[model samples]
Target chain A: MTLEASFGTSKIGADNIGVNCGTMLYNEVKQFRINHSIAEGKIKMENQVTLKLNYPLNEYVAQNELKLQFSEGTTLGDLFLKEGIPSDSVGFAVLNDTMLHLNYRLQNGDFIRVFPLVNGG
Target chain B: MKWYYGKLLRVNLAEKSYTVDEIPEELFTNYLGGRGLGSYLLLEHVQADIDPLSEENKVIFTNGFTTGTSMFGSSRYAVFSKSPQTGLFGEATSGGKVAPALHSTGYDAIILEGASAAPVYLEINDREVIFHSAEHLWGKETYETEDTVLREVNTPKAQAVVIGPAGENLVSFACIENNYWHSAGRSGIGAVLGSKKVKALVFYGESKTSVVNPELLQELMKEMAATGKDHAGVKAYRRLGTTQMVAAMNAAKAFPNRYWRDAYYSHWEKISGETLLENFEVKPTACPKCFISCSKKTTVKTGRHKGLTIEGPEYETIFVFGGLCLIPELDEIIYLNDLCDRLGMDTITAGNLIGLVMEAGQLGRIPVKLEYGDVEGAAQLLRDIADRRGVGQVLARGIKEAAKEWGLEDLAIHVKGMEPAGYDPRPLKGMGLAYATSSRGACHLRASFYKPELSGMIDRKTTQGKAEMLIDWENRLTIFNTGTLCQFFRDLLEWPNVERLVYAITGLEYHKDKLSEIANQIVTNTRIFNAREGATKQEDTLPPRFFKEPVNNGQDRITVEELQFMVDEYYKLRGWDDSGYPVHEEG
Candidate 1:
């Protein structure tokens, strides 16, 4: 659960954030993968994950499902910035069925869903 | 006199007489209109302890001060009466063409008193009130009733608010249906109408209200519409309607799943707004004079319920019939929604009752064979309840009375005999207080605190700072109700804009402080009415389940003591005593 700060490198070793790895480990392993193209200027596709955007969020994402590549230590805040979604516009996030904070580090093969800052009764 | 008609139509059904009475100017200045005016009239006219279904009870339909004007989101009307279900104050607001129609009839409100010897309907054309025999329409569904009334009236533009078999049978949660779609659907107002033996109130009028500053009102309305166009919340509502909340609520763990037992529904996507857009033909619909069309008209084209058209299975309807019942099929949910609308029943309370029956049956408290996810069985039960046949008779009494009769009172998920809307209060603590203190049983619209709590604007986990926020929201929403403006436009209408609208409509330039004082007075008046009706601090509480059980697998929980602390703070903020009674100033 620990997010490493090193860029272009697979620092996927420790559980620093105390995530419940026992249940999420299988989904992580199945979805996570690393592409080591060291010959190509060290462009690490190690944290490639799938993103699902629900209504209103999808209006910004332009699609319901997206496959995006994030830097190894990228958090939701970084991903939202890269994707041009205002951080303040996001109400909540769920990564692989577990609710996560904006600062939670993205893992390879992780599935993230972002919801807009909207509510109804 | 510009915004308001300053008159009410009084219909005495028992004597088959109708009269027009002038509304007091002081009452309008103090209470404004809509729910405020309706509540005031009800409190003054209806006896405190009379049976809601008795001949002595009164039903008042009130138009908002801005209703029928060129103001943004002003197409809403409030219906107030003593609830046959809760034996407390009952008020329900609806948006459609009916509000403007009623307003155009040259009346600020319509008061129905006494019971008719036979079923009848009223036709109001400007100031003329004509009583029509509704013998043929008595047992018809809402759609059929509206069609018949319109055909009989011979006016294509005539708008009728009619009750279906559910109301005729006096089901405790029956709702009044307008335009064969929209409903004032809570607290058994329809049942009260049923008791009066009135089938419909038809209006066919071309009259218009004069505004103080028409040009300025139009300019402000355009600006408000433009502001709404840029709002993210309005965009979401227009795109998916309220159904958009399914995914977000599930993510936040505020969704009520499986009769409030779980915080999340695993098959939520099947019933989410995305699924509706993907699978159905959704046509965006708007109320009269509304630019922000947030309602959806959907048609099921490829399912067992194919060819079924519905105005909405809005967020609450979807959660109640789909998530709470654990029914993953969207088609079935849409079918159930249509059934409730046609039967003139409140889908929230009806679905909650079904869920309770299923749970009670599982717990061996009842011999009923209903189980979770029984879509067909649930549909049949709804019809039976509307007709008051067999088990339907027991259920027509509502969950509180029904559960108590079956000795399963602890299992019912309700407050003051009204079922809570879709949000699970354990995760959103402010909603817990909102539900407990809402003037009409468990409702979200009374004060939609979830908007701030779920959007990260307020800390949902803490009880601190919630009382002040809740009071502020309640005041703002109370004004919205009195203004008769739709709550969807709340974000677009800031305080300054509201002051301007008031001036533009009524020529009464109220300052910000004046508006605030008016809102507080309205809230206090409603509280005093409830107190007179025997509501106490002890009745302001959540069900035992919220305190005893945890949601999201023990991740979110609120103890009874914590809820009490919040309630106490809320009372103090509202200038009420510790017992939650409104304190009055001595002369």
Candidate 2:
């Protein structure tokens, strides 16, 4: 099991991801994984990963950076949880320009995008 | 005569008479507009200890000085009365095109008095006012009533405030539906209108609200539209709507779960905003001149509740009807919102009462069976309640009375007979205190803490100075409502723009210090009006649940003692004796 992550200009690790899931979200996601058995596969992280963010709607990927590893069969919500962002904050998740669900499993070469419900119109 | 028409529309329902009365210049200067006007008028007119739903009660609708102008997000209005829910001073506001319409109709506010002998609707178009027969439209739903009125008047874009079957049946929590979807949703003012036999009120005016300083106004608007994009909360609201708060609050352990017995829900992902977009229809709607359009025009696509249409199953309704009741189904919640919309009911009150019913059922106090997540049962029961049929009659009396009738008074979750909003106070300790001591009672919008909780508008867990924070928010919000600006405008306007915008419109140049004084004056007058209505420090206290029982989870259990200390600190900050009432210093 391996994972990678990046946020902003900083890079943390290529083997593990960090998420500070609040008690409410923790209980729910914990129960969800247990019921679905999604964790039985080879998708565990050994070190923290880095996810970059910018203003507006940009994802954390570059053409050459696609082979960085740590993104095998992971869900958008799981990625957000790994990064300490709440699941609700990710209003819409996109992978390769297509809208993906929190339950959408990630592939190795996929670029992930997350948008929050910032404010109402 | 720039922004304000500087006049009040006075309607005596008993006599079926209406007139335009000039407002005093001194009144506008001291009180400002909208909420400020409501406070001054309430102090001058309404008495304490009267039945809140009686003819003696007065319902005043007021717009701010900038209401009808070109100022962005300046089209909100306030409704003031002695709340039937809290039995204290109540102020509920809404964002729509109506406030500016009132201003264009040559009035700053409309004050309605006495009960009508029969159901009637009032129409105001500039100088002309007419009371028409609403007998044919009395039984219509809120949206239907507005549609009928729009067709009759032949005005495609007119706005209205109308009630539903819930109001007709005197459901204490029923709201006055505005702009079809917006609502003055708290304190059961709809029941007051029902008691008066009034059906709806419509206003239409094409005249522009003038600005004293055009250049300054233009600069302010430009500044607002620019900086507004920087606000994180505004951005989230724009993208995800209020539904985004569900995930954030759930993560922060602030979302109330299972009738406040828990802080977290295990099925949150299924009901989260991300999931809602995946499962339901989400469209965008906005108030007049507002860029932050948070309202989601929703349509249920599946299940027995298919084709249900509603403006929002906002975070509050979603939490209350969905998570609070253990029903994580998004479509069920959307249908419930539509039901409440058609019934002209307040989701806050309805959700609270339904939670009470679930609590009662859990305790085996009521013979009738009910359970959390019973969406169909809840819907049927809601229908019964709105029509005052059987158990519905008991439920329509509100949580306090229903609890009393069932002989399980302690099961009711309320403060001063008002139900708490979407957030569970036990987990978010400061919010519990905020709800208990709210001037209107158990309302969260009085000063929502999610900004502080999630985004760092203030500190979340720090109760040490949260009281001062609450006061600051309430005071600033008072000025916001008085200025007739939308809450979203805070993203763009800030305090400086508030002063600049007002000065530009009214031609009254007041220093920043004078603006603070005006804000404080509005607060003091509102407090004094409550005092006249017999509201005291003791009325400001949390429900028995938060104080008596310890809401426990994996970690961070909260008890009554912790909440008590916060309440004490809050009262101290509010300048009240231990009780949380406004303390008057003798001159």
What are the TM-scores, per candidate, against the unseen true structure?
0.91, 0.83
Model 1 clash pairs are A1-A15, A1-A17, A2-A16, A31-A109
Cα RMSD of all models vs. native, in order, equals 6.5, 8.5
Fraction of native contacts under 8 Å reproduced by each candidate: 0.51, 0.15
Candidate 1 lDDT by residue in tens digits, B1-587: 45677888899999999889999888878878887798788777877778899999899999887888878788888899999888888999888888888888888888998999899999987958889999999899999999999889987678899999999999999999997789999989999989989999898787777888998898898887777766667778888888988888888788897888998888999999989999999999999888778899999989688999998879999999888888988889999999999999999999999998888888888999899999989999999999998889999998888988898878899999999999899999999999998878998998788877876566788899888888777777787888788988777776888888878887888877788788877777777777878889878999999999999879899989889989999888777888998853221
**Collision count of model 1:** 4
Q: After superposition, how far is residue A107 of candidate 2 from its true place, in Å?
A: 25
Clashes of each: 4, 31
Interface RMSD values for the candidates, listed in order? 2.1, 8.7
Model 1 chain B lDDT-worst window of ten: B578-587
